[model samples]
Target: MERWQRGDGRLIVATNAFGLGIDAPDVRVESGRGGRDGERSEAIVVMPAGRQEELQKKIARAKARTQPWKIQSRVMRPWETKQVEWEKMERFLSGSRCRRIYLDSEMDDRQDRKRCEVGEERCDVCEKDDAMVEDGEARRAAYVEEQRVIQEQAAQAERERQGPWVDSGIDVPSSSRNIPVPSSEVLVPGSVIVTSPQPFTDQDITSSEEEGRPIPQSQCSSVSFDQGFAADHDPVGESRMFEAQKQQRSQQRWRVEADSQREGHEVWNLETRLDSW
Candidate 1:
């Protein structure tokens, strides 16, 4: 145990790694001393686990010696102590005066004191009650005003759609009968150019001029065999390529089937070996 002075008060703190079993009477000072800020924040006092472990071991050894002894045991388990500490922390944080009053009524064990209120030693919250209530009311009023603005905007949009002129020529029917397009328009293959009013190539000769290919004097009609090769026949060396591709595909399928069967057998053997082990 070591003593230090802070806030003009002497604070005795335990750093001895174990409880010294000190029995000071009239302990006006709080236990867990470096804990003034921590008390306000509801944090735990972090004592090392060395002493707690030793205490548990000693208790276990004693219990082992008296295995058949018949006496009722009374001990505060860790969970019970934690619950008491948590309850104390919750009461300390609660903001309502009514809640604090109820807590005070429940835990005031000393009959010497009538109540926990201090005219001369007030807790921090007792001095600031009025401001908290005012802030809460202000926030509620602002929320109600924001909701009113959204409702007004929605109503205005509904009225605009109900007005007249929903049938005039300017209104434009939703059906295709009101839409206008020239009858000559039609889709032609290999080019997006419009061919209705005149031949599409009449509009431009620059593409042909750049390529230096004379536009074949408009052949009124003949399937141009020179344009592309016939699909049924292959040229010279290309005829044998198809046979090689077919053989390769057949070999790949055989390898895949054999590997799958080998994997299945290995899995079955592994399961059987594990069962024997």
Candidate 2:
């Protein structure tokens, strides 16, 4: 045993002779017929299926030797210990309860009760009916697909809204609508061109010269200025009528302020007269 513990011998083979008095902490693995230290370890026992009858006969013989005789006492002690050890090994291999709990109970440790109190870390039998593992995986898959669909829909909407601009082959600036274009050329369909009635082309200039009629500059200038101002201030106070209306509103505001001041002065005069009385 000392030689095995010191690594001088890697293996030890004996028939029930090397079971006791061996306390090597570094001995991690043991393969034999029974349990060793009451710590976390694995024990593998290989026995023939036909040996059940032989094991039963041995147990019966050991029970019969329990009679109170001087030699029987000596023989019964080993048999009782072996019987108890065999029964514990049988329970360990039964697979009905948690292996850790069974091992702790067999070794008379109270740690099994602590494990029961927590009730989280359980054996295969306890976790066999758990459905959350599958349900969580399904929910994660559905969420991923939902996010993918939302992203696809947003991308499709963006593509549809920008389709016209892309098809026209023009790098449309954000301020394109405010840019002035030539009257002869149309940049977009359905756009209304509010040009002057008398076109200012070279043909019109030659026709006016030949007809000996000069174009009225004042009327043309006023119309062009009004059109440009209307474009700048569309939908709010852009007409000549709106300018007159704004003037009237300013006069009304002045009248209201003067009336309020006059009433305040009258109240002050009345308060002075009451104090004198």
Best by TM-score: 2
User: Cα lDDT of model 1 overall?
Assistant: 0.49
| Tens-digit lDDT string for candidate 2 (168-215) | 443333333443443443356678555534537777778888999974
Per-residue alpha-carbon lDDT of candidate 1 for residues 84-141, written as tens digits (9 for 90 to 100): 6765544434432333353444455433433335533333455465457778889988
Quote the lDDT for 153 in model 1.
75
Provide the lowest-lDDT 10-residue window in model 2: 222-231
After aligning candidate 1 to the native by TM-score, how far in Å is the CA of 29 from where it should be?
9.6
Q: In angstroms, give how far residue 120 of model 1 lies from its true place.
A: 34
- The worst-scoring run of ten residues by lDDT in candidate 1 lies at 217-226
* Best by the lDDT measure: 2
Inter-residue clash pairs, candidate 1 = none
